[model samples]
Target: MTTPASHLMTSLRSGNATAPRLTWYGPDSERVELSGRVLDNWVAKTSNLLQDELDAAPGMRLKLDLPAHWKSMVWALAAWQVGLETVLDGADADFLVTAATDPVEGRYDAVIAVALPALAMRWPGTLPAGWVDYAAEVRSHGDVFMAHAEPDPAACAIRAGGGGVHSQAGLLEGFALPHEDGARIHLAAGDGLEGALAGALGAWQRDGSVVLTAPEVELTDHLLATERIHGN
Candidate 1:
């Protein structure tokens, strides 16, 4: 079956691949932009890591404990591409991805620590024992993803906290926020990871772009004009 992840990736890599697909504004005057091709590469590499290194497969659950950052978005896409169910409600999961400096051990089969900085090559400080360093490890993975096992469309895709569950095939239909085609949408980090992911899915599905602002970063008029934002 053509899983939602595979379909979405195909769309992302098609036509005008150099167009900016995701742009992020963060604290300390940080700005990161990723074109469609680049975004797809990141997602593919992360998916490879999940599938090859962590042995992630369909029907398994992976909890994303990070905030609404670009890296978090990549993780979500990677998990889905690997056919792992994304758990947003802090539910018990087979794997855990977090930015926490000292994540509790043995709770999950594997733990991945993510660094929020766009240019970070590795975790700033000493990495917790038994934890995978995303920045340090992801680059070694393949840039193209080929699923070893097909995903079940009828399986649960997202376990949204208090928002209920969505099947793999119905994830985008259920959670994607409506937007105009090719629109540049702005997202606030305060909306949480779930909201950001949903908004991103909505925008990308429409061949649009997303501009996400961190909590401390104000969405100024200059930013809106520069990013050519058409909707929120």
Candidate 2:
């Protein structure tokens, strides 16, 4: 099978346009739903920024030290599309994508910070020198990305350390969580990137939507029913 990142694009191209692909529930009851087409637009713009602006290419390492917000998924998909090895908090990387709340002192060639709050639009304060505001700059990039070259599935796509490397193919191999098509998988933000990856990839590969939640928010039956959730 093709990588989930690739399959996701195929799904979008094949007319999975208006369906909710990801629904994020943030702290303070913030909610956002992105359809496949909208999600693709974000990914494409992000990919364009990564490739065109940052000079990202195959074999470069891009660290994602972001929270389990919807934008994190966009960054991940964009990195994968460019064939950058996406790692979790791996200090040694060509690029580091994180939230504005994270420490900005790093040696990365490029730093992209995202503001996780809903409706925040842009980073509130002046960022450290050389850091890019994702929300602000991403909008300027084109909505379509044409990679200079094809990604190699056998190459490392994600590295969480522990002497293991998840290739593009491996990461795409859904985390084995059970759910039917269109199931809304709920994940807690406190679960972090690893937890989000497990649930998101699994649900996404199975033609299901994900509902990421903040730990503080209660997942009531009403919320589940209202969100059309099928799993947690």
Candidate 3:
């Protein structure tokens, strides 16, 4: 039915397939690049885990309480693919996903902890009861995900920052994306999740990629020129 995920999948397959879909730079000068297919693979595995194992379906609410890292972005797309609402807080959620060690403060149906480091393969410490390690469990799921029902784009997709809601269709509607010139977007302020989301969606819509920097990574002219980055 041409949901955002279906449309994005089509673009991923038919567009400039060789270009990088996302690139992440860490505070320690670590770099990671993901092609469209590779990004789709992550999304698929995440979707399978949320849908098949967790029994998450349409109308479910999931709290994305993690940082604005690559995995968090992947989980957002995965939740949208399975028609789950991605909320910023744990209020009225079926699941709360975070990178923090202590999530006992929140009451949720379940908790999933993600280890955010690039090389860290698993959660560092012991997880609380009923909590799942996203990295450890997600890899065991199939690489391809098939949704049981098509997502309604008009349905509420994200709830962020003190009661703001955005639908899947609205997220893309009137989105003015730059040309698909393989531009590398440099984000300066990493505070707003909604803004980051809009930028990512715009980049993907135009077959461009994003260069995300954490708060600690300083943006410099030399770094930008060396990276051949277009703009922020």
Candidate 4:
């Protein structure tokens, strides 16, 4: 059975796979771009890591403690692909994905520390014992994802900060922001992770793309013209 997550991935990889799907601008003039195929590959690897290494399965809650960066977006997509409920808030979760330098342990079953830099092959600093270094381990996982079991459409996909929930089937339709078809939308990091995710989903669903900028990055006229951004 094809779940919503799987279907979305399929759509993402269908046409113009080499076209830029997500572009990110961060502090210090950092720029990163991911094509549709590349984004799918990252999601696939992360999903495999979650399933094979972390033993994640449908109904398990995975909390995201990272910022609204491109890597954070990939992690969310991977969790959804593996049928894990992504918790944006709340304390009780089986797995915690964070970029924090010193993440508090003993709260979640597993803590995965992520490196925010686009080209980071491993964590920059020493990770606490027992914590998983995402950059170090994720590359060793398979580039393709195969679900151990199909996800239920009625299963919760996102747990919002306000304690609201969106089902897997309803996630895109209910939360995605409005956008014109094939438009290149600019997403501001100040909108937060949830808003960014929603906007990205909306754009992808409409065969559009997103240019996401970090909070510290300014949206200048030059940048907009260079990226060919249609709207924000």
lDDT of each: 0.89, 0.79, 0.76, 0.89
Candidate 2 yields a Cα-based lDDT of 0.79
Q: What's the lDDT of the predicted structure labeled candidate 1?
A: 0.89
Q: Which whole-number lDDT from 0 to 100 does residue 228 have in model 3?
A: 72
- My TM-score estimates for the predictions, one after another, are 0.97, 0.90, 0.90, 0.96
lDDT of 1 by residue, 1-232 (tens): 9777778887888788999999999999999999988999999999999999999999999999899999899999888888889988757999999998764744799999998999999999997788899999999999999999998999989977676788889878887778888989999998999999999999899889999999999888988888899964
Q: Model 1, residue 175: what's the lDDT?
A: 72
lDDT per residue as tens, model 2, 1-232: 3455777666864566888888887777788989888888989999999999999988799888887779988898898888888888645888988875567565878988888886877798998777888878888999888888778878888765366667876676633355676677788888787668767777777778888887788889999889877764
Candidate 3 structure quality by residue, lDDT tens digits, 39-141: 8888889999998888888878888887777878789888888888888764778888888876367577778898888777789989877788898898999
Lowest summed-lDDT stretch of 10 residues in model 3? 173-182
Give the Å shift of residue 122 in candidate 4: 1.0
Better of 3 and 4 by TM-score: 4
Ranked candidates, highest TM-score first: 1, 4, 2, 3
- The true-versus-predicted C-alpha distance at residue 129 of model 2, in Å, is 1.6
TM-score for predicted model 4 compared with the true structure: 0.96
Model 1 vs. true fold: TM: 0.97
Mark the regions of model 2 whose C-alpha exceeds 4 Å error after superposition.
Answer: 1-3, 101-106, 161-163, 174-178
Better of 1 and 2 by TM-score: 1
For residue 13, give model 3's deviation from the true position in Å.
Answer: 4.0
